[model samples]
Target: MLLISIIKTALELLVKLLELSNEGLHRLLSDAGFTEQRAKCQQRLADWLQGVARVLTQDGRQMTGSYAEGWANSMVQVNGRTAADSDIDWTVLAPGQEFHLRGGCERKGSCKDATPLQVKEGHAQVAVGAGSQPAVTATACGVRPAQDTCHAIECCSSFFKNRIRKLLPYNFDKVHLVRATRPSSTNELRVSFSFQEKDIMRNLSTDQGQLFTLIKFIFKRHLPLTLDTPGLKTYHAKTLLFFMLEKNDTHPSIEAWQPHNLIALLKESLDMMLSFIDSSSSPNECMPHFFMPDAPLYFKNAGIGGDFDNTKARVRDRLCELRSDISGVVEQLRGLVRPLQSEKFYFHPFTLLPLTAPPAVTEIRKGMYSPEMYYKFADVYSVVHQCVSELQSESSDRDTLMRQLSILQQLQWCKCATLCMTAMAHLKFGESEEAERLAMELQRHHVVSGLKPQDIQADKYDEPAKLPEDSDWAWRFCLPCDSPPRFPFLPEFTQTLFTARLSQPLSSHLYVNFRCLSWSLQAELLRNRAPAYAFDHWIKELLGDPDLEELLTLAHYSDCRWHVRLSLQQMEMIEKERRVAMETQDEENIGWVRQKWWRVSNRSGSGSDSGAHRSSEDEEEDEERRLWARARLGLVAMETAAEQRDSWTHTKVSWMRLQ
Candidate 1:
């Protein structure tokens, strides 16, 4: 009885600690606005890339990452986060657009007559005249003088006058790409399908995702000191998720997903590590590739078989946390047998899916990665629809209107805020001065709240988080906004990337592409809450394609689109009222119209006012302030890019093979 009491106390303490740890992690994760930061980083990177000439114009600029994937965890160190130790994974479309099958570098330790390109230093092959012509092997890339970094940039700029430029990753000082060559293989190049795995991960069941995440937490935190090393890649953990789910039996009920079952999940996952262990092979061996089973994950420094055995022993010794997480492990197995690990895998469950499905068809399909998003989005929309219905009523009470506005404010949805503020501004029939003041205040909070221009985060809207309406691949596979929505739940793919409630939960500020979002359609979006804003306008301008303004005309017939004529009619009436108020010198009437104009006009972040109280001097001062701020930002950008280039050049020279 005394022993039982002691055990119970220990268990209670463990649970309490786990709960607190979980809460603290949640708080830390929520506070880190990694999404915004990453978006800014990508934008800056993209902008700098544009300075690179044709590198920016190429099709493949993907912000593939944890923040982009909607799976960013608390610590960047553990989850590939951007806060502490972060790396940006930008998918660069090599300037040539076409993949040229090139000969692998000789592995003779040193080159005699030919230029020896060190594999460690990135070897980006650039095409010379055309596709048919032999490409220039741009290896041992460096400028002798440190100042020549600017010269190199200038040379590249002059070479490609009309070409689009590529962006560099801000987190990383320099771009790094490895074209892996096996010890003896000559013609073959091993290209890992990381994006393919990401797609598969996104499709994981909610329970599987939670289980994977928890195990990741344990792997990062409690792994024994001997076994924990950079040599053990996270890919091992990721591969285990899919491998287990492929064969691991699932309970018909939800019982398999309980926290108690999580231990069994981890134990089973750990036991599968045997698959990576080779009995008669070298002390170090590459992990089996889950994406391409034929090619395994080889590392330069994995040790001998006995060395791996020692690591396994160390890991088994450190199973105390794993045992603890279970909370109720018996002394020995009594009921059933534990499964033994397999030496080799011949089957992959991913291949069973129908292959004929088009890319567009595949997109509509999604795993239960974040099932909560659907419900949360529905709840937000329900509130928005209720508010819209109430506000439409001519006899709506002041208290009721305020209540609706309060609810909308609490949601912190820019869509609702835009709609509510617009209504308050244009409600010509009746609304007190207090309502107008409240509307302008919300708009003020929104505008001056540091919403960056459409350019910064505009690149983000074109990733997996978003898909073109179809695979509307125009301008070398750029997914246009007008791409139709493929997923039923994701009805807004054509315009908005992530709907307000469905996207990452942010409180401080929300950044949106106002190019797609017009002020006139603010109320329509609030009423419908679907991603119906057409991307034609934004896409056409960006790609230099002819404007598809013709399709937008058809949008009016649909319930989802804004009635432009009706909106214009309402604006005309307001303009007449403002003109008449100005002629009569009605200050009270002028004050209300002035606030309305501020709501619409000040959307550009200028904070301009045309009221009687306004002065020309203030506008001039604001303009000067903006100009100074921009000049400073530009100078900083140039200095930072130059520093990055110099650092990259230095690293290359150190790691390079001289001609």
Candidate 2:
């Protein structure tokens, strides 16, 4: 118990170093020279997307990927892994589309119940609603081909291909784009789009997502190098969770879940997979939402065959291996269970990874940081993690606790990491004035840096899929940073002082790099957003509102430097266009041209300036102002961006055009 407190105290020191100065992440990434690579990736992707969207306007189709869903905002690709071609889930579909019964075929009553979209026998991806935003809503449309323009199922296939080719850029061949398909019933087909899979994944409750990650991480660790033992994969684990939820007919509400049932939830999720393997031992059909209604994507059992038999063998063996690891796996994960579990109403597993001490902690403390139950050290990521877990385990008022936690998680990447942690602790222990100072500092850094609402938007794109009253106590995991800290100075020149000094300065681009925090705050903090993990029934049982207000105010800021550069280049061109439009006095043209750095501001009241002579009524008024005078639509946010530093990378701010 003493060591646990020491461990918590020790983790707190790392936070101080990170937040003491405003140059933490910048310094870390500058040495690695990763900012340039990321800028190139972001710029290239942005340019390509813009070009594609422009091309789509020429035809009847639209690029719904960015607008229908938020693009990756302030994307953090840790270890050079963020820029995969797969990140872009392009949805090239016709707008306001309604399926018309085409051809002189069997009479179908309505398009809602039947779809004419079908692929040729040999080809799989013929481009029909590629897991798109439900391209067509559930409206009863059964018009003749004469009005709607489709003659046969083959025509829809050809139309889809043509649309894809039309929207694709001239260098489409150079860019690798994978198109896949899933069979719906025998004749109907669904687009096996990865973006749609992402959409589904984002819908997972915080608890469900964590459990999925835990399962996948542990499963991957034990799997063979080739992963040839069975068809075990992250997708399989995810599917297991989806079915589990569907079986209980529950939303991602955390309250529906029994308290202290983390282990039970894990076992239940895995057992479902085990049952699935056993039932499908002879190779059977498996599709997402396979057991649920609204059967858009369907898979038919391929019947008995050599290929089918092989698949069955693989699945059976894989599931059996997973089943066998239950005992060992439970023990390994049990180490991470929250302490004082009996006390809390709801506790987040946000610090789930610190079962053992992280290397950063061990190295900083020189072996004194080790938890008694574990032998090895983890990393800086794990250290902060356990601290958060400790915080969560100690509190049940998720609403209040999340404010401090969210701020810490958001600022974890900056030199402000320690300050954020300190602020969180201060808030946790009722030290509001200290917490307020740290939070304001965070706000200053965020406002000046290039951090913006879009970054948070990208971070939270999937949050809308949850119930309105769920709890996010289970938490989210983000990019685990391996940034080494600049050490404390010694007046007497201790050996430790010289050894840990930073070798490089931070790049100016570090401000834009704030999105890849090792952990993200729970959605419970957002207005109307349900806790990522909650009991749906409990939501209904609540007598009053769950205080659905955002605890923190953070905005997507396109800072001074980036704005200046844009003014010189992109804005210059826009200005010229605007001048020409003004000369012509064309209202339409002027409206179409957008100005940079312009926004709809919901600014709050100015800082408090009350004197020590204030009465009790004045103090109460000040408190009221603090509580109610911030953001009107959402949480008031801190705007972050970059200005002066060694150097920085400039990327397109296309998402700013969105509200």
Candidate 3:
């Protein structure tokens, strides 16, 4: 009894130790910006591929592998210590049924239909028909299929790869593909079960998945220590994980897959792998593919690298060492996953534009004081305009909207103007509830708060206030201000290319003012909560003369965009009202309302005033009263234009822009 009691106490202590290690690992992953960087990379890649799909007219491209699975290690010290070198697995489904081929068995004996096997995840096995084939030649590729069919698949893979290569933009050389071939053929037929793998990874319980990531991360760091050759890849670890889960499914009562048993699970998985390594009596020496169980994953004749046994032996020893010191493993893993050094103001307005390359120093000089950079901003704005307009026609869930906006913001591709456009869209759709909620949230953003009339002017006189290094402002892919972004997430980079675009003082400052146009919509929403008179004060204080107008004029000078000039004109009119309000305090509210009516009427070409022809001068004298009637009509037209323009199909001016 005492011996059993002691063993229980020891197990409890081990469990406690693992729990602590897990906590440390979680914190390390979070701090390293692993998840955020992966997300940023994925989003940027998706955007690029979306454009590619449109151009190629393909069905779609799917992101797969560890990058998609969310446990991808972007920064690793092993395997040459390269940056942004993690392989992104993509499956580009071609358009049309051109590549689809019928499958046939290689064996010549009277072929019989194979009975469908039981599969997990509510999926049934596909019944193999005699003399018939699957769409992919590689599907159910257990035994060697027809060589002709395999050759067809290889041809299809090559065709798409070549087409993609031709379509790749300049400076995208960093993203290159290395074909995975079979042992028999130098160039093997490729089959992607990435979607299936992703689904399986997604279904893993939280702890189960984390444990797998922990093991893989550690394995990556130490695998190099074991040998100088390619022994077992990360995919091998994933296959073992899949097997462990399958084993756990069969014995559900054991609950060995839970968080507390992570250490046990790791040890068990390592032991199983070690058993396979030591099994000399067994003729088969390769691990089987998880999806196609009969298919060998590691081919002895493949000539990948090193002796398989020696490699596995080293791996087993290293893993056993990690198992003994789980806490030390966690600490060592932290060193492997280095958090990107935080650079001050790494994420500013310019970083968001998705330039093909960082702006040249000469271009930066021109953009800060000249109109040369307007075209780039215009291109970014055009895409963002299309994106927002597309969004307006369709309704998305709250989470979707938040995710889209967050991605846009993180990319620095969007300014305040874009969200304002979306909010106006919400209101137009009669989604007032969501619109108000969004507007209130925008009001709280640091960018909007920084655009306060006083703050805008103060930035010029005082040293520009340093952006707070708060969580909200954290940049996913930040480098030093002088360094050009090296990742595929941004444009291409040359070794000699060095510019301060990320820290451009005037452009970043001016971007805040441009985004501040959302204040008009925010104030409009605030009107429902406050009296009508309060609306003028909100607008006057936020968009009041001098500060906002000066910024607008600067923007107009730099971009020469028609919309910027129009905005400048509108601000001038508001400035006129501010002057009138100052001189005639008694009639300030009344004049403010009249000026507002004229501005709306001008854009819509109508007013509250009667349109009926005056019979005499007496009728003309009563035009002020008639203006009230015309103003209401004009407001309705403005709203109509707003609603229509929100549709991507329409090309009319946005009502919010006029404001």
Candidate 4:
């Protein structure tokens, strides 16, 4: 009875302890921001613990009864206190709290196996008050008490940093807001960041779109300030030009400034920038160089609001204008020469000689010459010479210009080889012999002076020499004859004493001389006869000795037309001979001759123009000849067989009579 009473007391104490633990769990939930929804959950957990404590108390009282003895004997169950008394330890699990076992746990430990608590999806509990259920809200902690909520601070800080990043060009180490009072206005906000200009420009230039956007934004805010700074202006100009060249947006705001003024400003900027490039240094030594090898030519004319089509047209016009200027300069220089030649008094910055006395300029300026002046003269002379040469046939002014250019070249004032060639080409249209003579003279002079001839005879003429036949008397004299005879002839024939030596016919030597003469007189005639004669001579020589069958085979493999023709002619001759033999009834000659003829004829048919008709005609002739030859031979064999049979019959009759 006393033990029963002790068990009842212990049960009441356990019940009180469970209630206290449940109350503590509710308070913890309220603190962790799960307050409003956790109240009912807390009540249910409290009731469950109360029922368990009541069962334990009732079972303790039943331990003294007979039914309790039977149940305990049947199950052999031990109480929690007895289990704790053995070697095992018990750990109580409270609601809303979990213990994590990192490593494997032994069964004898105080901790029991327990499943982890799964936090509600998309919700995290944040502690707000001590006694109320904890506030449950989104994982980002959107709901909480005023003092405890950090959402507004976090969001505002992130937004501030993002805006700062957009405004600044470089990465920032840290970004924050600090309150400070300003003189102009109180409670005003300002974003501050630090960056390096070099790094900013490097990043900007690498990203074209970003650079353009930044530039456009800056220009929009800062009006009336032309991008004229030393380091920055070129990049700005390049960006603007790229847009204009690609036909992108041409903002009208830039048009308020004069085009001429903008060009002048850009020119000045470019010149200043170029001047900074040291003339003595290599390109690699120049810092911040941007021009590529194939970079397009940029001029001051491509300024803002400058029409691109008009600019290109203006460039062409400027070239034409330069031609006129160069022509005028040449005229002025020519006039200077006249005064110098006439021994008239003159004063000019170009002339080094004093003009106080007669012949002073001409006499003193004989050997001395300036290379720079010569280069300029050459440039102008070439242009004038081309213009003149093109128009020489139509205009006398152009002829006079050509003559002036020739004089410049002859005086060694201009290295105008191309211009001279142009003039010579133009002159050749009317005076071919004169052009040829001049070309020869130039070649001879180059050879004498040990200089390579700039122009060769073969390069000047596209057509080969076209000597007319000797039958045309007028053309014979019209040919270019050398002053000194090219071939030696007998001199003073009337008073000559001739001696003759014993000699064989000079046909071979004469033929050789004739061939050389023909080649020299006209290259076209030589080209025409060379291939035919070469093939004919080769075949005649090769066929003379039958041992040249390998060469013939090679020729056949080459499939040249000459070889094919020769082979066909030979085959046709053989076939004709065989046919003649058959017609004459030459039986003994037919078989061997017919076989050889057929082989040659078949081989001859493998030629380019050996068409169906030609092939069929050859085949038909070969077949007819072979048939006739075979028929004639067959008749002869039949006659021989009949004669043998008659002789055998006579012998048999003689033998029978003798028997």
Best-fitting candidate, measured by TM-score? Answer: 3
| TM-score winner, 1 or 3 | 3
Q: Which one wins by lDDT: 2 or 3?
A: 3
lDDT of each: 0.32, 0.31, 0.39, 0.25
Q: What does each candidate score in C-alpha RMSD?
A: 23.4, 26.4, 24.2, 51.7
Deviating ranges (above 4 Å) for candidate 1: 1-57, 72-81, 93-178, 182-188, 218-230, 249-260, 278-280, 299-659
TM for candidate 1 is 0.33
**What order do candidates take by lDDT, descending?**
3, 1, 2, 4
lDDT of 4: 0.25
In the range 1-659, model 4's lDDT, one tens digit per residue, is 99999999999988655533423322222232222122222222222222222222221110111111111110111110011111111111122332221121222344455332211111112222122211211111000001110111000112223332432334443211122112222332211111111222222221222223222222221111221211222233333423331232223234322222232322333333343333313221112212121112233223334343443333234334433333332222222111111111111111111111111011111211222222332233233324323332343454554554454343321222323343244443454444434433332221011001121112222221111111111100000111212111111110011111112111000000111111122211122332312444334433421111212222332234445545444433433522111212122222223233333344554553332223454556445443433333243366654553454455445534644
Our model 3 lands, by Cα RMSD against the true structure, at: 24.2
Q: Name the runs in model 2 displaced over 4 angstroms.
A: 1-86, 94-188, 191-200, 215-235, 252-259, 284-311, 324-659
Report the C-alpha lDDT of model 3 over 295-347, residue by residue, as the tens digit.
45652334444354455555557656655666666555655665543311111
- Comparing 1 with 2 on lDDT, the higher-scoring candidate is 1
Give candidate 4 regions above 4 Å deviation.
1-379, 382-393, 397-402, 411-419, 422-429, 441-659
What lDDT is reached at residue 606 by model 4?
52
**Predictions ranked by TM-score, top down?**
3, 1, 2, 4
lDDT of 3: 0.39
| Ranking 3 against 4 by TM-score, winner | 3
